[model samples]
Target: MKRPIILLMGTMIFGILLSVLISVLFYGKNEVSNSIDAGTKKIVQKEDKDPYEKVDKTSPTISVYNSSTNKIEEMDIETFLYGVLSAEMSSDFSEEALKAQAVAARTYIIYKKENNMTKGHKGADICTDSNHCQAYFSYNELKKNKGEDWIKESYPKIKKAVDDTKGHILTYDEKAILPLYFSTSSGKTENCEEVFSSQYPYLKSVSSPYEEQSPRYYTETKISKYKFVNALNKSYSNISLSVDNLINQINVLERTNAGSVKTIQIGDKKLSGRNIRTLFGLNSSNFDIGFENDTVVFKVKGYGHGVGMSQWGAEGMAQKNYKYYDILCHYYTGIEIKDIY
Candidate 1:
């Protein structure tokens, strides 16, 4: 009876061993998987931390002179930025590009305010006239121009871009620089002295390889020789112009490093390229003139002043997956992006 008892104990021990093996085979994998998942979760949480979490969400208030209404409207800087971004950049552009514009626009306004550059805007910090300051449009104007569907679909995207980089501005040497930006470039940006006559180290000429998508990248404006001469004579009242000898008389006196016309001579009057561009309604200072029959063809390259950031080039970089900071750094050399609030 004792021998039988021993054999029974041994049989029970074997069954227990078999049960342990099965449990190990099935349950061990799930334990290891759970351990790996927990490790991955920790890494993802750390990586997804917001860098600007401590920044104040409350934007500073600014007085904006609405040129159309001719009234001073006091609103938060972000609210002002909405109108500026809507008028300055197209909503169809990449989010990164829009973010870049927001930062530049903010920097520009801050620079103006800090330096007391409010001489032109009466008591306001800035004006909405695109010719004077930056272009701007109210929400109602946007709805009128872009329609209700666009406001519902695309307007929120612009607001999001502005919010993502709130209170952020570009700076050089810890001071806000005059962050000038333009619509397009003539293959490269111009130096500060070349265009604005004031030299800023950060606003150096840089190669802009991505503005081919701009509609104004290459534009040809055809004007009658008679009209062209009259326009030039209107600006320089003493200059004599003959339509027959217009091409021969017109000579590019100087060109900037980026190939923009620095100084151009038409007849006896020497005019800066910026003056000629404004006087003749040319899209950019970088232009070539030629006669096609009785018409004078002005082949303009790019648009705007061709200084600081190139908006179309920023969009091109954004298309290649560049971030907003990357676009700003590429255009405005040696600048730091920091919170102004």
Candidate 2:
């Protein structure tokens, strides 16, 4: 009995000692890891010397401006390109989305001096809806698969798009491209004209709301077999002239939520709502409210904001074995990618 008690006590003591040793080992490792991380942070915090001034006629740095904040900020060419590509690739997207954005950083330094965005603010949203300088692409995507081929293929396309729009301002003839936030309340795509409504909580409400005789228009988009096919063929805008009466057909190329057929009384003629609204702005007292409803509609065609870069379309073309330049040229017109610097 004495011998058995001694053995049991010895086993208990050994177990306790093992637990203590394990705890000490874990704590020592955690402390070492913390020290290394702290040291790394210190190195990052140290100010990087600006060697840009002493160098030769160097690359152009992108300037960011905030119209609302009235502040100007600057970023490196690569960082600026990354920001542009990231935002365009996915609105508030991650940096890992594209492989193309990564490779563009290297070539942009040599080919172009600076990039610019007209309506885009200086901070996070620095690129625009269109392919001007800030286009939608990802270098990170290309880096994952196909390796260096992304540079050989994706570089010239983006560089061309950027080069073409470089030094060019967005304008229709002499009319400046006034930046207007797509009141998503009206739905996506330029097809919908945005009218201010108290319904939108995010936007500033219009003071002294005007009443209009025109039909209260609401944008509604739906994807069925027909809409998808129409969008793919770019024939969504085509108006039908002939209808086979066998099907009891409405021959019009109809819009989604335009209410009744639009009518305009101009002098002696009654024009359509679409044409009249284009000529004269919406006037109150012209039409009375019939019914009311609210909803968010996706009227988007193609994809990716229908702006500068179309990632879906690019992927589509890539699947068809289209070169990256062919994809870029299809979306952006009159752009040449050249090595300037």
Against the true structure, what is every candidate's RMSD? 11.3, 21.3
Model 2 compared with the native: what TM-score? 0.30
Q: For residues 1-341, what per-residue lDDT tens digits would candidate 2 score against the true structure? A: 99999999999999999999998876643412211121112101111221112222344565544333456656555445544544444322211213322323333333222232243443432433233434433455445643576567655554444333332222222322222221111211221232321221121211111111112222234333343323323432343322122122221233323122234332223435444233223221122212112221232212111222234433433444444443333333333332233
Task: Give the number of the best model, judged by TM-score.
Answer: 1
TM-score of 1: 0.81
> For candidate 1, lDDT tens digit of each residue in 1-341?
99999999999999999999999876653413211121112101111222433376678899988889889989888999999999999999999899999999989899988887887687899999888889998989999999999999999999999998999998898989889899999878888898886999899888887889999999999999999899888878878887776778989989998888988888888888888888878999999888888999989999988988999989987876667876787788788888866
The runs of at least 3 residues in candidate 2 whose Cα sits more than 4 Å from the true structure, single-residue gaps closed, are 1-58, 67-70, 91-309
